[model samples]
Target: MKNVYITRIAKFLPNEPVENEEMEEKLGIINGKASKARRIILRNNQIKTRYYALDKEGNVTHNNAQLVAKAVEGLCDDTFNKSEIELLSCGTSSPDQILPSHAAMVHGFLKSGNLEVNSPSGACCAGMNALKYGYMAVKSDQVKNAVCTGSERTSSWMKSDIFEDEVAHLEAVEQQPILAFNKEFLRWMLSDGAGAVLLESEPNGKTPLKIEWMEGYSYAFELETCMYAGGEKLEDGNLKPWSEYPADVWGKMSLFAMKQDVKLLSENILKKGVASMKLAMEKHNITEDDIEYYLPHISSYYFKENLYKEIENQGLHMPWEKWFLNLQKVGNVGAGSIYLMLEELINSGKLKKGDRIFLQVPESARFAYSYAYLTVV
Candidate 1:
């Protein structure tokens, strides 16, 4: 197989930074009442600022496809155009539309002409999933290069207007006065942004990062869905998809609202991933001493210490100095996270040739994880 290296990386964060204090002002209060869960969630998330594609009045400035197109457009200078792109792969937990697929929409926005395109779907690990597609495409000699992106325009769904119906539905059904914690929790957690990378058989910059290996595991059989959207978890722990329900209740129940089984997440998230991380490292002969940087796509600071301790117990001890995170600044961009972190690290000017960078991406959608190793070369 041919080797693949990330050639160019770029990111598009929509609009201006919305500070923590300004969140309610921008996202708006649901049912004309302040969220009781907002402060507690934000306190644990520790997200100082996050980007949103909506204005104070809830007007959209950019859609998910537009966010991706902007980032891809930044991949090359003015001379480069989308028509030359060999393959386009996009991943997102939140696609603007369900039918056309995210890549097709992005291709339309780019007017990129005919080319291979792929759209991978999931939550946080979706970005890494897209990157792996590009890496394999170039490594297998199927494409000279591939453009891959991971993005989210979650602000479109997080707006208070989207939940107003559900709020009223709760009152009619269960006498619940407001949106449930499961439904409203994400409104304060998610942000909007997109990140893209160019992958080629050869390295571009003098210090390009080489994709040494990629690994992924799924535990859907061993675990129920920990996070989900477009459906509700039944008493049997199975999902009753939105299609199965009557259309009227869709908006009323907020069936499409993204949520997690907090109990499942708190229990298995750190445990399951570290076991696989240890085995993968052992199989690859990677050791604690060899890793110089660790980039984990954590949705909140709540997991920082727990992740470190778990990995440490498994013998991969990366000190705080070795950890590189932007969650505090970027909030949780879901699938856009790893790409954004890689972009920031590569631009930080601290990397040197031969440095080993470890990436850990955990997806709570169904207890999945994707890990990759990169060498600065």
Candidate 2:
């Protein structure tokens, strides 16, 4: 089988930085009743800086396609872009418009028509989904090269007034209202960013990384646990309230999704390719000591802490503190988080040729858990 490789990767983030403290102060002024509650939530989340696109009046801006275009341009400048590029796929939850998948916009921006472009809207998993699709296209010999881009500008939908009102109500009641208003709870954590990767059949030429195999799984139980949309537009031309409660209400949703993905992966992919890195490593011609790194999706601080506990319980080797610290610097870039970390690992010399790399991406019901098994080459 021909080896599919990740040839190039790049990312772009908004210039404006919104620190957590700044957000808290702003919210406090806007809704004095919720000042204390908002501060507590912000402090507990431990988010330092999040990027946002703001106008002169301090309103959030939405520039999803523009950022995606920038990332793609970076990839093109770094790599040779032939007119015959076979595929273009964009993974995004926050698209510029509901119509015309963001992929089409990217295709237009790149001015390439000899390729089939797919716009995948699997929420957070969109980017990984694009990668998986590109991998299959190249592995099947259907395409020689492909590009996958993930970009999101969630700040566009942040309704300050509605968010302030919701925050005030929640504080007065001492309870979060519902999923629809949970956006305020997470507003401080989301930022605007974009990342892109170019893939080819093999690294016979210059390239950054190579792909080994990709795996994915979906849990139907999480179908209604999370959702995203334009929301109700107001007369003032702003987004309405966002829903974030169903996910918490269905507390086990993510865990269920994880179990389903792990079960399928262990049986179909890992068992066939390599033994569990935790058990009988030497028997499989490998050992836990052989792995230099492991990368997984960065969901949240709480999720990460719980995941660490779970890994310890399972006796799996824990990643270095550096990996967790990196998350502190960038928060979570959605689908781009894992790939961005992979790029950093390679560039920082932490990864070397023949080093095994494992990446797991779990998306909400809109998408699903998408895993990739790659080796540094």
Candidate 3:
């Protein structure tokens, strides 16, 4: 079997780190029940500081294209030729536009003409999917070099009024939709970051992580309605696209109209995550003991203990102490998370040459999961 190696990794986080207190103030979650609810969400998530693509006044400072391009450039050797990159795979929860594709936009920023590009935008699993594509492209000998990027500008969507309007028009405050209730919850939970990795068919003296195997799974698309944007299934069983809403909900809401069932998500994500891990281990012909480092792209610290418990309940156990988490520092950055985690571990200089890394990536919107086994070389 041919091999693909991750030869380089880079990350771009814009602006200063924003703490929970500052985010709460910006979102006006001060005083009353809103304040209490904000505290619970922040404390439970354990996210202390996260970056945003914001200017000094807290406005969006960069778009998805700029963020991804900067990250990819960071991975480049100063003397490297840009044209050697045969493929560009990009993934993100939010994109600059729907037509040109995120990958195309990145190519434009790099001023590289006609290099192949793919935008595998599968919500949160998107970044992993993008990496998987680049890995296979090199493993199959189709590309000598490929760039895989994942970026999220969630702050752009954080200020939407759709959810607030839902609260304002509620027949009773208690009857407000989950979207309304959890709107500000995610606002404080999400931030901005971009991560990229350079995949090469052969390692050229650079430290590389040899890719052993990768697997992905998506269970029951019907569950997609559990978390989504641009549409909603009301309590009365009617499907309402953003267009069905009032005029104010038409433009920005169409781009960032998000709704989620927190209860259903929490219940299913753990089960699906463990199942995916089992499948990955089986395919890679490994056991929990084979793994030296456990890296999971989880959404929050609230789910950390639950994930471990589920892993044990599945009749398998991993070295929990080997697990690494950056959510407290960067928040849930969607697709950019896994690469950022890997980057941190690599830079920490802790792993031995032959160490095995178990990577778990779970996406909430589609209830999807991806796992990869990598070996340090």
Best by TM-score: 1
Error of 3 at 220 (Å): 2.0
| lDDT per residue as tens, model 3, 225-275 | 566666766786345776667776454233255556687788899998898
Best by lDDT: 1
lDDT against true structure, model 1: 0.89
For model 3, the stretches where C-alpha displacement exceeds 4 angstroms are: 26-35, 160-179, 221-224, 236-240, 243-255
- In model 3, pairs of residues that clash are none
2 versus 3: better TM-score goes to: 3
In candidate 1, list every pair of residues with a backbone clash: none
lDDT, model 3, position 205: 35
The TM-score of predicted model 1 comes to: 0.97
RMSD of each: 1.2, 8.4, 3.0
Quote the positional error of residue 147 for candidate 2 in Å. 0.6
